[model samples]
Target: MRRLAFAILGLFLAAQGQAQSIVPAPPQVAAEAFILVDAATGFVIASEKPDAALPPASLTKLMTSYVLANEIAEGRLSRDEQVVVSENSWSQNPVFNGSSLMWIEPGKDVTIGELERGIVIASGNDATVAVAEHIAGSEEAFAELMNQHAERLGLSNSHFMNSHGLPDPNHYTTARDLAKLSAAIIREFPEHYARYKELDYTYNDIKQYNRNKLLREDPSVDGLKTGYTSEAGYGLVASAKRGDMRLISVVLGTSSPTARKNETRSLLNYGFRFYETARLLDAGEELEKPRVWKGQVDYAPVGVLDEIVLTLPRGKRQQVEQRVALVDDIEAPLAVGDSVGTLTLLLDGELLYQGPVVALEAVAPGGFFARLWDIILMWLASLFGG
Candidate 1:
């Protein structure tokens, strides 16, 4: 009996030691739906019912910002362009509407830049409506444009009923879709994303500060948007970059402001703690030397079009591997950016992302005489054994 008691005690101690060495607990979040994604690779780090559709509230402004960025990029609108505030924007706001506002009187002129500041820093519903009207000529038309852009971005779980994320039952988006949208904005528009980090903006002398508490909590937290309503609850789409790793986290339908902040912070912490980013291929890294039939060079260098970076869990770096393949015998004429081959990333034997390798420079077929000689050689070889 004494020996058995001692053995049991030893077994219990070993069990405890093993438990302590296991993976740490995941961070806790209070939101009803949430997702954390690595911005570089689109790899989902953590998600909780990320696909469930819920009210987006003012988070709809992310789509608004995306549209504005594209317009600015295309030269259709300028930051200095003036927009007139209509009765639609001012009449709905009183001291009681709980809406953020610049308190513009009807016919007051506001610049596109100020409108962007109002939407981003103040979460102004009126600002959203005004910007939408200015951009598309009507809020309804702007909503259509928003949905079209969402479709182009492959936001499958999203639908837009209004420019402002009001509590319309039809206006809904999934946490996963929101994260994708946020990532697209950050990846596609670096210059425009800078607006999200501004702590305060003065419109008509009313200084409105950004409500995203995470930006104040962590300097690395730069963007993107926040939302709240009785029906939609509190939601936030937040992003931060620490070193080479950038992450986008979305929390939807939280009970309170504190819960939204806490959940977003926890999700970001969890993502940063357990994951690290690795660059598998540097930009312009040559992958192959495909034979060129003609032109100035005998071989054309095949290289990656862009750097391939991935975010992986800690201690799993050794598991990341890549395979490069090139097209069979190249036939001369090739232009820069022409797809030549592919570099596939694999983790634990599962394909992650396949990056296409492109031709570095143009290669034209050789002189007519050289081409004729090659054709004759090929024909003769096919015609006779000798």
Candidate 2:
């Protein structure tokens, strides 16, 4: 009778835990496609049609910026240098209304720095075209460069046909791909990413405010870009960092600029409220020191090369469990960064992460006598289950 009562109590407690741990459904988002992701963990907090191909509009400038950042990073371009604005990239080269010009008239020299500000803060089509022409000799070639980068970044659902994100039937990207791109920009080139936060830029005596309204409203919304076109509707790829936890949101094909802003806020709010990203282990954090057979060192330290972070329901971080799957007979000579084992983290027995454990330092082979002794010890351990 006591055993029956205990079993029932245990089941009841488990059921209660499950009920308490349940995460609420992600908030409903009204857009053609949207995604919210934890920047550090690359975990999707909530998403709908993230991979659906859709027009990205001026958000293409992010890629244009990314390519330019890559160029500067690789020493092909410098910020201080200047490029001449061609007739094709003059102020009169207006297609879309508000973003038509940065006053970059024909045959004038503009520094790379000003052009970047013009592109990001002013959303100038002329500045983007000038950059495209200066870097790749033409927009067509620059687009090829963009596509190459897209492929390298594993943006499977993205394709770029122009440097400026003016509406073209073939120029399209996905919410998931844009999220990845934004994260990459923030992670890889922080210096350039910082430019996205500036409120306004002045070129040729005309100043315009950044169209990303969220930056002004939310203290956390530091950067990213906004886009609009007849086909793409209004799109915003916005990122905000409340603390160490940064979130990237993508809302595409909304009815108006106001809709995109509110929808993005909804996604960000849902993510920050319900989920928290935790860094479980730092790079080279030794999780185990396993016995090394036939090596100079009796024990070899193993750990991850990169930090491991995960996004889980808020307040549930303490419930995670860690496990190691390493070889029993770790014969050496082991080199630094050699694969030693696998480390896994689980929540309620559900796998969250599984990655390789590498040797923290090299281990040379032992002297002949030491090796013989180790072999004998290994043999005895196998026989006696030591």
Candidate 3:
């Protein structure tokens, strides 16, 4: 370990000396449960009963859409492939009890791309079941896939019982879990995520506007989905990006769709006003080149293997510090990506993050004379208690 690069050392005080003020308290919301998080850093900015298990209502479709999109992404399914609308899926349509639907007819054929738009934009239960049936052969099987995706996403507080978010006591998700799921979908599938921005979707000559109202009212709000049922009230998982920072807001159990949108907007506003996310470093950017003992190359370059991003209270970023800690002397025959040191990050002297620093390139053993010289130097250094 060459004591060359990853050392937490400096008091890097930069930026204007802006006074630190208490961030305004999070707003009281009408929703029973809600959360707001920084998408880039996954830092929760605000929450109220975020983990409370409650009916996901239509929000359940978020996972359904995610699973279907993933299948396409993995090349197991194609967007243009035709799928048949089964009688079971159509029965869950608007013909009964005002269910949101794309009005897909039973036994009719439709493309996966159209159903994707229908599920995301129109909240079409029929389309959802059709896609589910096409993918897994039954809604029950599709729900199992949904659960697998939820588990993979680490949504411990969530479970799915259906493809479309019809009300079921067994099918529920929390605000925090929904936020995480939404963030995953947005970050993992940018191309498919764009479908959420469509204001209206038309199928079977019936056009329904997207249920997420934030898109119309806020220019920064680009995507996500909305959900509502008599039992679930109204729920929404919304995401908005301004500049380089994106925020995810989940509001569950609002009295109405408008309430969900309003609460989500409030949370987004608070996060944007009170916090800032910054990219601190890029992966593999050489931070230091330090001397290596008995190596073919006289030095080895070291840096982080992953990008570093931080979300901090607004105006408090100037107080952040960073230092690197590395070994006293590096030896030859070091492999690329071998752990070399550690980089510790702190804000206002409080440790916030620590990550491994690794060698950016390999170092081979040196010639015999050089090795001997290094050996002698090492022995001498040990005698001096170095």
Candidate 4:
């Protein structure tokens, strides 16, 4: 069970007076639940019932798409590979009435790339099952991979029981988790994400448009998915970018497709209107170059492992400040990714975020004479309280 790991840094900023009302109260929405988050910082700007595990409908395809992207990235799968559609994928049972489909003929072979577009643009339930079977041999097995990925992503309130989100009591996810997964897709797999922006796709002489209405209605809104079912009302996971800031909005359990799209638009609009993000530190940007005692190199460079980004009130960007507290003395035998210091962000005397400052490169032990000299120098510096 691999997990997303980050060293925790203690925040020492003291509380000032209460902050001014930077952003207005969020708009009341018709959806049962929704969330707005900063894609760069994973900061929740506003949310309602973000943790409730309700029916996700076809929004579950985000995870399915994520898994496919991961396999391609890891060299285990290829977009050009042809996958044959299984009978199980083509036939929607009498009890189950699926939404949109790719209309793939049983035993027909389709490229993984085409299937991906079918899933993204057509919201194809048949294409989803074909990809799942091709990847993991069965929908049940692919679902295990989905659950594993969900747990690794720290989605405590989410679970997956199938590839195409045809109603299952066990297949459910929260708005917050959907936002995180969408951000991961955008950040981790930019190449595949472009398909989300595609408005129309044609397969077997049949043309279908993306169900996410926001793409046509708003230029800023780019890529994401929309879902619907009798049990899970119309739902959408949408993302939009204005300037340098990107936001993800998730709305679940709306009465109609128009309602889900409208609700998601309101959330995205509120986030962009009231909140902004600033990139404080680029990945590998040197924050400190400290002296290393008894090492091959005299200095060791360190920085935040990933880009440091912050989301704050619309007009509060100038108030952001940062500080780093490093180890008193760095010794030899340092690994490339060791966390040797802490970095904290503060705004108006309040702590905003913190993460470890990691070594940028490895440091090996120095020669005997060099080691001896550094030891004496270290002692002398300590004696003088330097």
TM-score of each: 0.80, 0.92, 0.93, 0.82
Residue 220 lDDT in candidate 1: 87
Candidate 2 C-alpha lDDT tens digits along 109-200:
79998999988888888889899999999989999999999999999999999987887889999999999999999999999999999999
Q: Per-residue lDDT tens digits of candidate 3, residues 1-386?
A: 34533333334455378455478889999988989999988899899998999998778888999998899999999999988777777845443358888888876678999999989999988888888899999989999999998999999999999888887779988998998899899988999999999999888888899989899999999989988888999888989998778999998888987788888898899999888897777878777887789999888888887888888887665566777777787788999888877888887778878888789998989999999999998899889887
Candidate 2 contains a number of clashing pairs equal to 0
Model 3, which residues run further than 4 Å from truth? 1-11, 14-18, 91-96
Score candidate 4 by TM-score against the native: 0.82
Predicted candidate 3: what Cα RMSD to the true structure?
2.5
Better of 2 and 3 by TM-score: 3
Candidate 2 residues lying further than 4 Å off, grouped into runs, are 1-19, 94-99
For model 1, residues 95-195, the per-residue Cα lDDT tens digits are 22876665566778888888877887887778888888898989899999999999999999899988778777788999999999998889888888999
Give per-candidate clash totals.
3, 0, 8, 0
Clashes of 4: 0
lDDT of 4 by residue, 1-386 (tens): 11122322233333477355467799998888999999988999889999998989889999999999999999999999988877777746432354688878776678999899988889888888888999999989999999999999888899899988988898899999999899999999999899999999999899999988889999999989999998998999999999999999999999998888888888898999888897767888887787888999999898877887788888676556667778787888899889887887777679988788789999999999999999999899879976
User: Model 1: which residue pairs collide?
Assistant: 294-366, 295-365, 295-366
The TM-score-based order of candidates, best leading, equals 3, 2, 4, 1
Relative to the unseen true structure, what is the C-alpha lDDT of residue 45 in candidate 2, on a scale of 0 to 100? 91
Roughly what TM-score does model 1 have, to 2 decimal places? Answer: 0.80
Displacement of the residue 310 alpha carbon in candidate 3, Å: 1.4
Q: Is candidate 2 or candidate 4 better by TM-score?
A: 2
